[model samples]
Target: MEPILSVEHLSVSFTRYRRGLSRAELSAIRDLSLTVEPGQVAAVAGESGSGKSLLAHAILHILPRNAKAGGSILYDGAPLTPDRAAALRGREISLIPQGITYLDPLLTVGAQLRRGRTDPDTRSRCRKVLERYGLGAETEGLYPFQLSGGMARRVLIAAAVLDSPRLIVADEPTPGLDVKSARRVLGHFRELAEQGAGVLFITHDLKLALSVADKLVVLREGRTVDELPAADFRRGQGLTHPYTRALWQAMPEHRLW
Candidate 1:
């Protein structure tokens, strides 16, 4: 089957400035490329500041204006650019960032969902999505401030899937939630993939990735150092690359805490 999303030799860099000094270029991602086939779940894992989020933003064309990007990002055989990428986001591709602040403060959850959707049937679809994620109608009618942390996270997720995008890119989707809620959310993503939506699950939690991802891609210093099947991940086998081994060693399961 053809890849739902294909990234080739993609690179992204940002410019930073210091007082009384010229701007400096900081490379966030370098020569990173991967593919997400229909109904596949690929996990990208690394320490913070390892360009995991940058890779996602580059694919979605949501990188900051000061950032420069190069290389080809194709969605369904078409090259993705700022103009064309906008049409893909939320309709063909959706992203759920790490934080829950994507929603508006003043708008009710229902209103926010309606605003982010691409079609008119969003209201009913939103209700179904919320219910599927264990959220109730009262949660949808309330404002963001009125909901719990996990409820707000579910709302943001509902907004992302309101249009049933063919690919969903989620960054650390399980942070701050209890173990049970995390498991529920991961189960939902599994159902989404089973139904043929390609998912890119970016996370730092190796245990969660092992349980949820079909494939794992390990990144280090803006490069993909390892890629392997999820079965290998479950076995706790030593990684082929040194960086990947270090990542596994740093996982919570291996920690003394």
Candidate 2:
């Protein structure tokens, strides 16, 4: 089966202006490539500046104006242009963004989850999704400010999967949650993958990635340093890249720091 999302030779650079008439280009992501197949969870793990979030924005066509991106992003074998991405976004492709600020402060949870549809079916699905994430039907009446950090995060996850998107891009989705909540969210991603959806789980937590991902792509200083099975990472095997090995060794279980 074809991969649902394929990013090949992806590069993103920002044009930075220094003094008058002086400018330079800074690359944030260089030559990054990965694939998320249906029924699979592929994760990209890196430190803060390693460009994991930038990859998600590039795939969603939400890059900044000063940023210039090169290379091809294919969705189901077709080039995913800006227009195509916008068209498919929310319906077929959904982003569980890194920040809880993605939720509109003015809209209620139900309103955002419904996405402007007031039909009975839409409302029912919205309630069901919220409940699945440990939220109650009464939670829908709450605003962004009314929610706790963990509640806000769950609201975002509930909204992302409400439409049953085919490709889910979750950037740091488990942050701000308790262990049980985090596990529930990750388990839901696996369940979605099992239902034939491709999931791109992006985060800085190597252990969390290993727990939920089938494939792991390690990034360092804007480049893909290693790509291997998460199983290999768990067992500390097949780690040829020095950076990847260092990351594995730094885990608490290994304690080789």
Q: Which candidate ranks first by TM-score, i.e. highest?
A: 2
lDDT of 1 at 183: 85
Q: Which stretches of candidate 2 lie over 4 Å from their true place?
A: none
Query: 252 in model 2: Cα distance from truth in Å?
Result: 1.9
Clashes of each: 0, 0
Question: How do the residues 130-206 of candidate 2 rate in per-residue lDDT, one tens digit apiece?
Answer: 99889999999999999999999999999999998999999999989999999999999999999999999999998
What tens-digit string does per-residue lDDT give for candidate 1 at 73-186?
898888887898888787788998888887789999888888756464776787888887788877767998898898888788888877778899998888877788788878
Model 2, TM vs. native: 0.97
RMSD of each: 2.6, 1.2
The deviation in Å at residue 146 for candidate 1 is: 1.8
The global Cα lDDT (0 to 1) of model 1 is 0.83
